[model samples]
Target: MAETSETSAAAGDAGAEGTEDTGIDPAIFSQLLPFDPFDPAFHADPYAVYRKIREQGPVTRTPLGLVVVPGHAGVSAVLRDNRFGWGDGATVAEHFSEAPDGTTVRPFIFMDPPDHTRIRGLVGQAFSARRVDALRARAGELVTELIDKAVAAADGGPVDLIDAVAHPLPAILLGELIGVPPEKHERFRALSTDIAHGLDPSLFLTPEEVTRRDSARAELYEYFGRLAEERRAAPAGDLISELVTAEDTDGGLTGHELVVTLTLLLSAGFALTVNLIGNGMYALLQHPGQLAWLREHPEDVPAAVEEMLRYDPPGQMISRVALADAEVEGVPVAAGEQVMLMIGAASRDPEVYEDPDALVLSRPAGRNLGFGLGVHFCVGAPIARLAAQVAVAKLAALDLELETATPPRAPYIITRGLRELPVRLTAAD
Candidate 1:
């Protein structure tokens, strides 16, 4: 990787032979600088803003020293490139905090290889494709049960889909897999929401937000720590118990690692999947033609799920730090510089797919940075796909008549989804 001069004279000229300038308009970057992505206004309709950034080109450098990769190729490259490090705490300090404790919250998903490899290796077996498939039938049964309940309660009136279906489907499935008691699901949901909401720096005071997050983390750690202990004493059929007893001949996970893995799975699992269901459903309702097509051909559900991920991903952006001087799409980045990959924009880039904005299930499956790429790709992706597939399939099967209780957008930049989607349902003839 090489550094290049940032000047108009050098901008148009190709700096490196193999690398091409992303040719992003500098003005677009200036526009988004003042607008916080987590603002309610932005979330209400981020696609308009995303369109402006994507049209400008693939990459732009923000005033905040963060490079925003908007198009498919540029975003994909950053995600796949190993020169970028995911777990650099120094970048967190630069962007969000300066506290020592902030540096100590080591999420395994943030680590580079060897460290990442070791941790992922320990937990990968549990999320393997076969294991995920084995659970799909049971997952579908849960989805059917929930939808039946929703229909029963509708009574020709609007039903809050988030509460009745979208939220609970994944929550219940994940709870069962992790061995969380049914009664504790509500607590887990609240805690996860608190932790996610606290991620936006503009929303809360640094100290207050940090404290809230740390407290939530502590509660999770304590709860899972106890669960791990119980599992160790008397193993069960659930994931936590299996993890407790797992060994590699050399040795098993330490208490700390076990707890962190549980924390990662529990926190990352349901929230994103819930958003996937919510976002996917909202997209379908907006495009009634697609909704009808799905109803006519339920077999297309899997492709519909993929389209949802590409059109409006559950995650909007992911961050990484440069491990060394790197030239990405002609932008000069030094070691420790933070890069923000705009997944929402990238998924809609015309370069990667035709008519990127329109929801076309017939479109051939294309590469997407939705689950990310490289070593740090989402570990729970299999379970997420299964959960979303089941939820969407069941929902499409219903004769749905949707109504917005309160406009369907959540105020968050990191995760893209609806806060609520109320709908009136009737059984299909």
Candidate 2:
């Protein structure tokens, strides 16, 4: 609390700004109870702040004049209610200085209805149950191949799972899903990294980030557009082929839209899957009983994956704008106001689950907004879930232990993940 007081003095108390003060300092408050999606502190440990908001009330009006909804019901209500939407450019332009055209290039996930509905239906078609199920075989193969490499690299030393297992497994799988040839997988990572970094609502970007974003978008357009054209002509078996050749009758996506959609799939799938693998593995190792149970019953991999998502989700924050004067669970919301849903916090809401903070592998099935809900739900969710289930199941099958050295986490505010998790693989007796 003393530390919080010092932070309040340094950053100015919220009380002075007419907002009811959280005992935590505004600087600390910004991190924990972040009104700003890019708040540096909240990126550090948002779970603490999520708890604070849930405890205070379902709806929190931040010092930034932003509405933060933390409870599962409130967050779910906001996402499902058509009253809230992705809002116009003016809503986001206040923070990001990207060009207006650049904003149009925002991923389909950031698009509201009509456009969201159209693109999602088209993109969603590519990830049919059969397609995703077939992709699972490839995911399993990649997991095995990556695990072998991790063992070889370990050669009696600790292995960084991010390098050998977590990252490569997903990268290769995503490349295959998008029809990228195996040889180009190495370069794919750098491109995906650059594109994924801009997936946030930020006040500003460093000159470097701006450069990377522009470069990534251009490269994606050129690269995927080439692949898309080839697929349209050749009609190969992969997702890109399906997308290019998909006939919607209501006029299919334009060439530029196809390129942009492919770009979103490439970057979003890899980034989220990587985080899911890293975060889930870390969570399981942190809770040995749960880890042991998963190892003993591999058939439970699906439920375990679900629990992992709820325990430590990759997508932390999702927001929407009130399309018009509206109310969330009866709380009056003026037209055009922005409401941020804390995904990670909502999962831990006591009202939603028993022992909300604990990791329980056998926890009863529930709707987790980790992949989000409603119209904007993750289109690649099936593929992501399958990939993670295989990765975690395989990893748990080994009698390994997390390395004593603290692993480095993906320090970015956008995705919560570990960059390099070193673990010691042990032979089963």
Best by TM-score: 2
lDDT (Cα, tens digit) per residue for candidate 2, span 317-337: 676778889887678999977
Tens digit per residue, CA lDDT, model 1, 1-429? 001112111111111220223434434323434234324456666777888877766667666555677777777777678888754454343122112233344456656787777777778755667767778999989887877787787777787778787788777777777778779988887777665544433212245545676677778878888988988898877888877876665567777777777776766666678888888888888889999888888888888899999888888777777888887787777887767777787888877889888988667889867788877778888888899998898888777766863445655456766667888787576
lDDT of 1 at 286: 83
Each candidate structure's TM-score, on Cα atoms with residue i matched to residue i, is: 0.85, 0.87
Ten consecutive residues with minimal summed lDDT in candidate 1? 1-10
Q: Compute the lDDT of residue 94 as modeled in candidate 2.
A: 24
lDDT of each: 0.69, 0.73
* Count of clashing residue pairs in every prediction: 1, 2
What are the RMSD figures for all models against the true structure? 8.5, 6.6
Can you give the lDDT of residue 278 in candidate 1? 87
Model 1 TM-score (2 dp): 0.85
